[model samples]
Target: MRSFVYARPETIDGAVSEMTAEPGAAYLAGGTTQVDLMKDEVLRPVRLVDITRLPLREVWSDGDALVVGALVSMEELAGHPVVTERLPLLREALLMGATPQLRHMATMGGNLLQRTRCRYFRDPSVPCNKREPGAGCGAIDGFHRTHAVLGTSAHCIATHPSDAAVALLALGAEVRVRGGEGERVVPLTDFYRLPGSTPHVETVLEHGELITHLEIPLLPRGARSGYLKVRDRASYEFALASVAAALVVEDGTIRRAHLALGGLGTVPWRVPRAEELLRDAAPGEESFAAAADAALAGAVARPDNGFKIELGRRAVVRMLSTLAKES
Candidate 1:
């Protein structure tokens, strides 16, 4: 790893200022993903500003939302009483993301800011538009079985690998960030940038903006939500196809349905077409199948990963069915 200066500012403003002063400096929270990239020489930040000591670990309920401080550890958030009681889907997603030991060190902000797990981007030897813009993409006709099928561009096709963010997208969560100008709250769905002509730009955050907290607006009291992940193994591997589905059923039909797909898109894929199909439809095989089909309507799968189209559909169908049964 390259040598870099380290700083642990006592205040958020100070930390932000330090990062703003050095555009190449990276804000370090749990040091999980950032550390790995540094060792690989893929990311050579001239400085590392530690934000662990900052008082950003608070997790509580606001008037009608769940406010999660950015520095809150994944383990703590997943096991928090409020999370288990009000957001079981979030708990399940966090627990499924990483092993116990890693979860203890992974922070909320870090997870959301986690980089894509595309092999081309990770292996500095290979060319990746995301890693080095305009260098060319090696995964175009290379090993793309685990790459994205949605929100992909000619420059890049990398799948987002955040389980918590996918659940948050379905739950309609927003992130509060402290930037150079001021503080702002951005919806999770809009925070990530698509790999368009400029695949290097990943998120909407400015150079030194710090994510302060995440807010999940209150959900219906009796709504049923769950996450289903399909992977190559049962261990803490990345998701091949995952679905976070929340459904509110009244009488015998669906009242409101929220669906987000992961491991199949460039971001937390919110399937509005699928939600439109299940908004007022009855909970059954036919409706669920239709919703699943709508979710994959725009999927353009690569040759090796064409199976993901069907696999992603099945995941959505299964999650909706499970939520329907529970509701």
Candidate 2:
């Protein structure tokens, strides 16, 4: 591993100032993903600013919105009564993601900030535009079975790898950030960026910004929600395709819907069209199929990941059906 300077900040302002003072410094939380990447030479920060010591861990209900601190671990969020009861989709997504041990250690902020799982980015030998701009994307003509089908550009096809993020997007949560500015809230849907010219920049977060917490606005009570993941394995694997849906079906008609897809795009893919289709449709196979079709209508697929378009649709359909039954 590369030798790097390390510092732990007790205050958020100190951490932000330290990071802003250094161009190539990263905030370290669990170090579960960042450490491995450093060893592989995928990432080599000049300084590691430890932020786990900062007091950002908390989970509470603020009126109708459920607030979860960035330092809160997946295990803590998943097991929280407020999370499980009010946002079952989030708990379901967390349960389907990483192993129990990792989940216990992984922070929510770290998970949202995790980098893409693209092979080209991880391997120094490969030519990836994301890792080295102007080098060209290796996945373009190589193995891309796990690549993106939406929001992809010539520069990159790498997809985001967080199931929890998808659920967060579907729930219409907002992320609270602190940086050079005092504090600001960014809608979760707007936090992630599409793989445009700069695939390296996965999020809209500024250089020294620290994610403080996330707030999930309340929807209809007892909302029917579910998260479905399709992967190469049943457990301990990255998603091939996944859908997280929160639906309110009442009197045999859809009242409202929130839809977000994973493993198919550069970010947590929100399908406004799918939500529109489910808005007033009856909970049935035709309705679900229509919503799925609307969600993937204009997806541009690569050679190896064309099947993802169908897989994503089916996953959405299955999740909607399951949630509908529960409703």
Candidate 3:
């Protein structure tokens, strides 16, 4: 790794000030993703502002919402009593992600900000728009079996690789960001940006901004939620297609539904149209199929990834069916 200046800030204001003053300064929490990128030379920040000492490691309930601090580790959140009992879908998504060792070190904010695993983006040798804008994307024509099918632009087609983010999106979570000016709460749906002409910019966060926490409204009493991941392997692998679903059924009729997809889009894909189709419908294969169709309606596939469209549709149907059964 390259040599860089390091600073450990005791306060959020100090960290933001130090980072804002430097053009190439990065916040370091668990360093799970940042260290890997630095080792690969994909990211070379001039300074590292360590915010591990910041008082952001608390998870609690606030009225009808669950508040999760950015510093909370994946394992810690997955095993927390309140999380397991109240947000089982999130717990399942967290557990299905990286192995135990990584979960212990990966924080909630770090996981959401983790970069894509695209080979071209990771290897500095290849041309990738995400790694270097206007350089062209090699994954567009290269082995793109794992590339995205939804929200793909001619400039980039890399898939997002965050299991937690998909579940969080499905749960309608909001992010709390702290910056030089002040603080703002951004909805999770609006946080991620599509891979448009500017694929290099993936999120709405500014350069010096720091994610403080996330808030998710608690589900209703009769709600049933779960997560399903289909990958090439059973363990220690990323999802090929995954779904996070929550449904509320009343007297054999669906009252409300929320569905989000991962491993098939440039961002964590939320299918509001699919959710709308499920409303007031009977919980059956026909309704599930219609919702699945709506989920993949705008999907466009490359030569090597056309199978993902069908795979993603099946994942949606299966996840919804499982949740409906639970209800």
Candidate 4:
């Protein structure tokens, strides 16, 4: 790895000041993904400002919402009683992600900022528009079985690789970020950006800003929620397609539903069309099928990932069907 200046800031202001002063400086949380990327030379920071001791590690309930500290590790979240009880979908997503050892070292903020596992984007030899602006995307004609099928531009088709993000979007989670200006709240759905001309810019986070914590709004009691991921392997692999669903069926009719898809978009693709279709519709094969169809109405598929369109639909149907049966 290339040598870089390092600073351990005890306060948020000190960390922000150091990060702002140093161009190409990155905040170090758990250092799981950052260190690996640096080793691979995919990321080279001029300075590394350590924020692990900046008093951001904490989790608590704010009356109706679950507030998760940014520095909280995936392992801590998965094992937390409140998280497992209140946000089972998030817990399941994290459990199915990286192994125990890595999860213990992966913080929530780092997980959200983690880049795609696209071969072309990771390897310097391969041409990738995301890695190098207008360099052209090799994944378009190369191995792209795991690429995105929705919200993809001709410039790039790489998919976001966070299962936790999918569940967070479904649960109406909000992110709290601190910058040189101050703190601000951004919805989880709006956090990630669609790959337009600039696929390299993946999120709405401004430079020198730091994610502080996550806030998950209170969902109705007795609501069923879950995450389903389909991959080439059963475990320790990224998703070929995935769905995060939360539904509330009342007297055989769907009263409320939240549906979001991952592994198929540049961002966590929330399906308002599906949500609208499921509203007041009976929880049955026909209704679930209709909702699934509505969800993919705007999907634009690539040559290799067209299968994801159907895979994503099947995932949504299966997840909703299972929720219906249990409810």
Task: Give the number of the best model, judged by lDDT.
Answer: 3
Candidate 2, residues 13-75, lDDT tens digits: the string is 999999999999999999889999999998999999999899899888899998888999999
Regions of candidate 2 where Cα sits further than 4 Å from its true position: none
lDDT by residue for model 1 over 1-327, one digit each (tens)? 999999999999999999999989999998888899999999999989999999999988899899999999999999998788778789899999999999999999999999989999999999999999999999989999988889999999999999999999998999999978989999988999999978889899999999999998766789898889999998999999999888889999899999999999988899888899998899999999999999988888888989999999899888888887883
TM-score, per-candidate, Cα-based: 0.98, 0.98, 0.99, 0.97
Residue range with the least summed lDDT across 10 consecutive positions in model 2: 217-226
TM-score of 4: 0.97
* Model 1 stretches with alpha carbons more than 4 Å out: none
Per-model tally of clashing residue pairs: 0, 0, 0, 0
| C-alpha RMSD by candidate, in order | 0.9, 1.0, 0.8, 1.1
Pairs clashing in candidate 2?
none
Q: For residues 228-252, could you state the per-residue lDDT of candidate 4 as single tens digits?
A: 9899999789998888898888887
Please report, in order, the local distance difference test score of every candidate based on alpha carbons. Answer: 0.92, 0.90, 0.94, 0.88
Which of the two, 2 or 3, has more TM-score? Answer: 3
Better-scoring candidate (lDDT), 1 or 3: 3
